[model samples]
Target chain A: MDSIKVFAPGTVANVACGFDVIGLALDAPGDEMIIRRSEVPGVRISAVHGADLPLEASRNVAGVAVQALLQKLEDPKAGFEIEIFKNIHPGSGIGSSAASSAGAVVGVNLLLGEPFSRKQLVRFAMEGERLASGAAHADNVAPAILGGFTLVRSYRPLDITALHTPKDLWVTVIHPQIEVKTSDAREILKQKVLMTDAIRQWGNVGALVAGLYQENYDLISRSLEDVIVEPIRSILIPAFHELKLRCKEAGALGGGISGSGPSVFMLSKGEESARKVADTMNQVYAPLGVDYKIYVSQINTEGVKVIG
Target chain B: MDSIKVFAPGTVANVACGFDVIGLALDAPGDEMIIRRSEVPGVRISAVHGADLPLEASRNVAGVAVQALLQKLEDPKAGFEIEIFKNIHPGSGIGSSAASSAGAVVGVNLLLGEPFSRKQLVRFAMEGERLASGAAHADNVAPAILGGFTLVRSYRPLDITALHTPKDLWVTVIHPQIEVKTSDAREILKQKVLMTDAIRQWGNVGALVAGLYQENYDLISRSLEDVIVEPIRSILIPAFHELKLRCKEAGALGGGISGSGPSVFMLSKGEESARKVADTMNQVYAPLGVDYKIYVSQINTEGVKVIG
Candidate 1:
């Protein structure tokens, strides 16, 4: 195929107690990209839509991600042109850049007759993440590429595990249209945490993974607690506490900040409860006169797929 | 049943990255107790053997545990006499006190016509834990009652989850005849830890739980890491670094301090590998002129069972 079109889903990272390690993919609010072979001997960003971003290949996330993938080849003579139709807003804390990065690598891999496996593409995609966030973190990119829930077990040698996801799991996310810079959100966190709180966090993380495997909703709800980062970062978002309380009252299992701030997510057992959570989120933000966007979707099983 | 004799399995608590939350039961080197209905209306410890311990009802771990269980009933007039035949050495860091505590509750519950579920016995068992260690932690008691691998997800409400155990999983434990007080171990650890280390720890805990459910041995090996407590606690155990290295080299998955220190445990995929790991442990400590004991057993599927 001379050209390939693919759709890459957005992701929710730092899932409650699984800060900086666990992430899940969403079905909606993704980015679509079309990558084509180029006559020139270098990668290029042909065009972009729905967002104003850098057109330079070296500066664009997709461009940098595809370059990382091509560099692994022996000959390294392949060239590509990429066009992005962005739907996920940048700085929304819902993995907008991950979609672009994951999609670019996936499309290029397919166009080259699939030289790399999906797991291998995560490191290439993570390069773009490094360019975007200054840290080559895999919490978002792994789920975006692998689909479902993922755990970055270790980073020194880059180990990632795909965890079981229940079919009934649904997500409701709201972006309050306020900017919470990732750097600032990260800066607010304390360098050290109490051993008591750390123990509590890992207990929840282990239980959450067990709940997913057993498909036990009550266990999942009890494990969705974050004592370390949420208390500090939640202050940056408007109506954060009220939104969480009302969403739980509306039948959400539990939730916290989606990634860093601005966007908050609640997980429910079924789509009906997820929609109710979205409605509750709307009610909380409406009175505050905050411009917010809501999206209710199931856990994305297919991370990035060929659309055309 | 008017009288009940029972066997309660020993356990390894704080299994690597699951400090303060996780534990697994062992098949051998447990405690045997005979609990029978007494004419009196108060708990009593009638006989003790194989170790030096208090005989008073309130002073003994098993007596304290049985008292806690009886206190839950409105008109708890039931009195019991317990005879202990201890096999697991106290302060070996392999849940020695837990075996007594768990055995007492299980035996008494059986004599009372099974009024409480096995899960309900954990809290009463934990009262014994509090008496032994001054902290009511359930890592050891939960596994001793629930069997297999167990997670104490939370303590305030006492949430426990039983994790899947691979069929071929085996354990090798070496208790170096040395004293490493639990209080000393707790006192040595810092009150706070770096966020980076905490994230790495939770990542391993989550992945370890996932590995258990999936029966992925390689993943289990990689995730059996203790970055927080092991570093400082290993200093207390003689040749701990060497034991871990030699165990891994001898086909063991990975291991660390069993509970606090002195005793070390390694997990292997099968009984044969577990035996090999035991031989390596012998090679390490036999030359040190340090007295020690070793046990090799399968993962206990049944927690505590009535013998008569």
Candidate 2:
């Protein structure tokens, strides 16, 4: 085949309380890309969906990952025509950069006869992120590539491990109409933390980890609390507290900001509860006169994949 | 038999990052208690334990739980001879109170014709802890009663969950001679935390939990990091930095205080590493002139049990 089309789903990064370390794949529709073999080594890019992202290899996430993967080839002369479908917006806490980077790597590497392991491909995707975010962190890319729940333990060695997310977990995500830039959100964070808050956070961290292994839903729900980030970031999202309170009251297991916010997500027990949570959230936002989107989705165990 | 001899194992409470929530039972070498039949409703306590623990029913951990369990009976008339085999030290962060409580509940429950479930027995144990610490936290008691890694989501309604622990994890613990009270150690902590650190702690928590399920040893090792409690508590364990440094240099997977401890525990790849870690810790404490106790053990899956 001279060309291929691949679909990369949206993802939730910084899983509440787990920030920057945990990323989960979302089944909700995301971005797409089509890559075709060409004679030039560098990628030629175009976007069909997202608003005016730079096409230059130096500026775009997908462009960088494809470039890195091609440079790995014996014949650096290999080229590709890349078309991106950007359905999930940047700063949505849904791994926008990841969907782009992962899509490009998965699509291009397939065109290259699949010489690299999935881990190698994920590493290649890291370069895609380096151009945009000052640092190359794998939280987003790792899950987009490997699926399920993922942990980016170390960035230096680029260690990425996929975790077993419980089968029963249902995720409800709402992206508000308001826009919050990723860089701006990151800038708001303080460099240093208080010692006391740090201990509570760690204690919750300890409890949360134990909860997941034991599949203790109640423990996981209690541990879902974010005394640290959620309080700070919720201010950026519209109706954060009211919406979250309503969702929990409507039977959510727990919920918090999705990444650096403007987007919020909640965990619900079953389909019925998930639907109830979604309705409750939308109801709270109804009076805000803001255009918002809500997705009552399950945890996307199967992540990025083929869609022709 | 006028009195029956029961052995309750020492345990590592608040295993690493699992503060206030996780704990486990150890093999062999623990506290021993003997309880004999009595004619009255109230529990009379006696401790063979060398430490100056109070022998009165209202003051002793064992006596308290036995007293509470008997109080629940319609016929409150119960009598017993209580004897304790003091193997685990009270302030060692090995679940001293938990062992005593579990032993008391076990012996008395057997005497009362087994009125409760194994879980119900844990509830009885928590009652014992209330007489000691103002809070009836079950991180220690649940694990001691049930064995393995226990998650105490809430102490109020008594929600406890047991998690699977990987068999390959060989534990190496170093208990220095210095003593630090849990209350005092707890007092050193601040009530608040930085959002960033809290996020990282939870991420590691999820990673650690996922690691246990996936049997990803490297992830388990990496996730073993305790960024919050260790730094504060380690200050009390003289030369803790050197001991940790040596353990890492000798190739241990990362670790921290066994509980709220003077005891440092690290999980290793195998028996050799476990022994090496023990030796390294011993060497680090030599200059400090602190005598040490060591456990070159493995994760104990079996929890509270009567001495067979």
Candidate 3:
């Protein structure tokens, strides 16, 4: 096929206890892209719609990710033009850049007759992450490419493991129309943490993975705790504590800031509970007159998929 | 049933990536205990064999643990006499005190018509741990009581989770004749750790739990890494680095200081591989003239079991 249209899903990183290590893909609020073969010998951002983003190939995240993928080709003869219809807003902290980057590489890989595996595509998408936020973090891109739940076991060699996802798991996300820069959120964290707290955090992380594998909802709720990053980063988001408490009271298993956040995401055992969580989010934020968007979706089992 | 005899297995705590949170039970090299009903009104340590230990109920770990269990009863009228046949060496770092404590509680519970669940026994066993180590850490006792692999998810209100145990998994452990006090080991560790290192450690913790559930041997091997405590504690064990290197070269999965030190343990995919790892351990330690004892056994699914 000379042209392919694809939809790439957004992701929730950190997952409470797994900071910089775990993430899960969402089923709604993604980006749609059309990638077409071009005679010109290099990548190009031919068109952009929905969001006012740079069309320059060198400046765009999708362009950077596609270029990184192309660099692996032996002959280097392939070229492509990408058209992005963005639905995920940038800096909403729900993997907005990851959707663009993951979509671009997945679309190109298919048009190139499937040269790279999904895991390899993650490496290319990481280039986009690096361009977006000065660090090559795989928490967002790994799940966006591989789907469901992913654990980045190591970063030096870029090891990623796809964890078992429970069929009943659903996500409820609320993105407040406010900016919380990833860099600033990162800077607020302490460079060192107490060994006792670290032990507790790792304990939660281990139990969380086991809970997912066993499909034990109560275990998952008990394990969804973050003693490290959330205490500090939540200060940047408005009404963060009340939102989390009310969401959990409304039957969310648990949740925390999505990525560096103005966006908050809660996990529920089923779709009905997830929808209830979304309504509770509205109730909490409505009093403050905050502009927001809410989505209740099943856990996305397929990351990037062909649309046309 | 006025009298009961039981066997309580030893455990490898910390388990590389899960410092202070994870542990697994072994099939052999455990402690044996005989508990009997007494007309007396309180717990008593009546007989001791194979090791030098205090006979006073308050001074003995097993006695203290049984006392803790007895205290939970509303009437508090029950009394017990415990006889110990110690096999696991104290200060060997293989949960020696835990076996005694767990065995005592398991035996008494059985003799009293089974008053407590295995998980509840962990709390009473932890009182033994607190007496032994001056800290109420559940890593070792939780596994000794619950069996297989156990994660101490939280210390407050004490939460324990029993993880899946792969059928083919085997353990090879070598205990060098030396004393490494748990208190001294705790002092050697820094109170604070770098955030980057902590993240990598938790990543491994999450992946290790996933590996256990999926029965992915290679994934387990990759996840058995300790970036925090092992580096410093390995110094206390003689030729630890060389032993670990040779064991891995002999096709063992991976390992480090078992519990607080002096003993080193390696995990292998099968019993044959575990035996090979034990041979490698002997090869590494024989030339140094270090007196050591080696045990090769399968993962123990039953923690504390009645013998008679």
Best by TM-score: 1
lDDT of 2 by residue, B1-308 (tens): 44666777777776666666667777644677787887765778755666678888888888888777776765655677688777777777777788899887887777667777778888778887787777677877887778776766555556677777778777787777678888888998766555555555655666666677777788878777666677787898888787888898998987888778878787888889988988888778777777778888776676656663
Q: Which ten residues in a row have the lowest lDDT in candidate 2 chain B?
A: B191-200
TM-score of 1: 0.98
Each model's TM-score for chain A is: 0.99, 0.93, 0.99
A136-170 per-residue lDDT for model 3 (tens digits): 88999999999999999998877899999999999
Interface RMSD for candidate number 3? 0.5
Best model number under DockQ: 1
lDDT of 3 by residue, B1-308 (tens): 88888999999998999999999998889999888898887899989899999999998999999889988965467889999999999999999999999999888888777788989888999899889889877888888988999998998868889999999999999999998988889899999999999999999999999999999999999999999999999899899898999999999999888999889999999999999999999899989887899999999999998888
Model 2 CA deviation exceeding 4 Å by range: A72-74, A190-200, A206-216, B1-4, B71-75, B127-135, B154-159, B190-196, B249-251, B279-289
Off by over 4 Å in 1: none
Model 1 global lDDT (CA atoms, 0 to 1): 0.93
DockQ of 2: 0.46
- Candidate 3 residue pairs in clash (backbone atoms < 3 Å): none
> What's the distance in Å from true for residue B247, model 2?
3.4
Weakest lDDT window of 10 consecutive positions for candidate 2 chain A:
A195-204
Model 1 / residue B6 / CA error / Å: 1.4
